[model samples]
Target: MYRGRLAYRPRSETANKIREVNKMKEGIHPNYYQAKVVCNCGNEFVTGSTKKDIHVEVCSKCHSFYTGQQKAAAARGRIDKFNRKYGIQ
Candidate 1:
């Protein structure tokens, strides 16, 4: 509903008929290309995309979650902060 007005929706039969009669506009969609994705950690992969080339800083190969390093680093930071605040070695 818009502005408290009931929304208009076609019935199932009408909707099916409209779908059969209408079709997607040609030449309006971007072309899919075999895109080359380059990661900062030297990881490269090919995937379908509208763009031909893509550059990224991180990839699954070196991501902290994939390597299981983010949690350790975060915990170490918290522990250090707590220790400093309490003047503990």
Candidate 2:
């Protein structure tokens, strides 16, 4: 990023258009978009609902609730509604 007098003066109309295009690219698809967050200490890694792998550092198996271990980990309100609707135990 150029700053102060070092910034591109854009003397020509073409130069201005080029600068604008560059700005738009920076505005979208930023650098961090490619980096999926891996859980730091073997907890869980999730990219929205798209991906889950267990037992590895970011796996679903190691996550406390995902494997359904800690008692009835699911929230009671949602579970009751689901059971009532689907006749699930």
In candidate 2, what are the lDDT values of residues 26-89, reduced to their tens digit?
A: 4555343323445646443444333343234545555676767655655777789999999988
lDDT for position 83 in model 1: 100
Question: For this target, which candidate reaches the highest TM-score against the unseen true structure?
Answer: 1
Q: Candidate 1, 64: how far from true, in Å? A: 1.1
TM-score (C-alpha) between model 1 and the true structure: 0.74
lDDT value, candidate 1, whole model: 0.95
Q: TM-scores for all candidates?
A: 0.74, 0.24
Candidate 2 TM-score, C-alpha based: 0.24
Per-prediction backbone clash count? 0, 2
What lDDT would candidate 2 get against the real structure? 0.58
List the lowest-lDDT window of 10 residues for candidate 1: 1-10
Query: After aligning candidate 2 to the native by TM-score, how far in Å is the CA of 47 from where it should be?
Result: 4.9
